[model samples]
Target: MVPNVVQKGEVIAIDGEWWNSDPIKVEAEAKLSGGAPNVSDAFTINGQPGGSYNCSKSGTTNFSVEQGKNYLLRIVNAAVNNHLFFKVASHNLTVVAVDASYTKPYTTDILVLSSGQTADVLLTANQAEAKYYMTASVYTTQGFYDKTNTTAILNYVGSNSSATPIGLNIPEFNDTATLVKPCEAWLRRSIQWTYGHSSSLLLQHIRCLYHRLSFTSPVEFNYTGDVPNTLWAPICGTKVKVIEYNATVQVVFQGTNIFQSDNHPMHIHGYDFYIVGEGFGNYNESDHNPFNLVYPPLRNTVGVPVNGWVAIRFKADSPEFSCSIQKFYKFVKFDDVATTLDVSKGVLAERVPVGRDIGG
Candidate 1:
């Protein structure tokens, strides 16, 4: 486990063992210089520095955190597939917000985090004596991966003399915390019934609104002709023409036969977005869609249906537009091997502004 001192805009490194087994390397790199690092590679703790692992690759290092008395823990599942449960031992972690919006703070022993979902917590480690473990492990809500990874350890001040604290036992996924589903209304109501109150009024409100909305007919189109035609033109236009910093951007991710999953956890960098709405087969135009007009979750990542489409709306508002938003754009272009093969056609080109923001 990795122990971190709460500070605003401070980057923290996480690496440890999972399920009492071998150690797995967990590293997060900052997206915007001093912010929390995005996970790039997954490595075995016992393997050599540049060895192979699942979810994350290699060369991914240093997750960042802000330096302040109270801050948010922006957790993202870099793993292509896997849900996680994050918890800190011997402390009542108060979740202040989620997906970058302020919410009523509620104390909890553990927080359930899904792939591509970010949770912000207000943690104060004021204990004078005693060591606590802050853990992020795989949840068995769906299927099983090889083993859960040890994300970090939170050591109380004065627990150890040295700057690096000793590791703690990796918690088992079989624990009750891992099995519970906090998203279900019944389960949440049960918690409120037992605790006699609710901590997340925002979540409660969102859940009510989400269920109340009636889904319209799914939008459909010919995948082979329409998608390639639509995507290729924009991609070509965006690649060659200089894009203004203030341009409004919309990215629609439509899953194909190659990627046959029902849903994909789509993540964005630099800015949070309104989900708008999503459907099973295709997006609809006509029925009463509440999410179309109402405010959805403001998040950095969202899940796109496997055979359907998920539309995301966001403004290009980052100072260093190139650094903050380039990664996501790069991933989309290189998603298929055929696109990478036509370099001579200038399908993939690099553009650099000479005197741009050097910090990015």
Candidate 2:
């Protein structure tokens, strides 16, 4: 979590549905074991609801910047259960960092950020002296209770204008293909984990001994929390995923489940993972060949493509006992984890079984 001590712009973070969508509620036994997606609902920005009957744009603010100056715009996805699409009017963002790690200065008009992820971009106020709408909306896979466009305006200094800021074009709602097929090749990793001259041995060790884990959602929609024995409950737990220190780890988040297919922005706590590959349907060894060891995007939080899977690799360099507790369940497990983890660890049960059944 980035500290508030740093300078940050005024932008509303839409976490989850406001009414009853809490982190604890999403991991409830009913949702985990019973296959209920009782995540968050409509939320208010800075305590202000949306416009046009709580579904349209709301809680708009203004950030005044001088003309002809470049500013570093740091965007964060604080949503607990959703990935957001962000854009500004007539501006091409030069992305430099993601999840606090640097990238290859990729430029784009719109960027997709999942929950808990951060993108640092350089925005140049080269446009005319006017206000432009900087909008944030849900980039969803499940066509559910999506929110209206959440916006803030980029106002120019020395301009005494109360006119409405011009809004830019956001991606079409429910456009997974557009979201998945990124226009630019951001999958290349700009950073490499080499320990000086021992890089070859380090890579060898990482390739030989590695831990593979899989995470998925429930299969059937029920409320009794009595899922069949074939599935794994999305409950919170500690002391889970204990591994030896310095072990190489490869994790695959499978999205093709029997219950429902959705996009999940998986976040890691200690280190960033090199996003090796992402594709549709189940993951097969022969099918997923020529892994992007050359250059892949490394991030602490990466997403599982809707109804698909994503593969990531990283060294377990940071070792510590981390805890994963259900936000509402009062149950705190003291896991002796070699690699401390975030929320996704709990939802991940053993490796994906044969045939890639999320539950069985």
Best by TM-score: 2
How far out, in Å, is residue 215 in model 2? Answer: 15
Residue-pair clashes, model 2:
14
Per-residue lDDT tens digits of candidate 2, residues 6-86? 333433333333545555555555445654455445533433334434444444456688887777777776665567787
Q: How much lDDT does each candidate structure score? A: 0.38, 0.54
Off by over 4 Å in 2: 1-59, 181-184, 188-243, 320-360
lDDT of 1 by residue, 124-185 (tens): 55444444445566544222244535434454444553343333344465443333333221
What's every prediction's RMSD, in angstroms? Answer: 13.7, 11.0
- Lowest summed lDDT window (length 10), candidate 2: 196-205
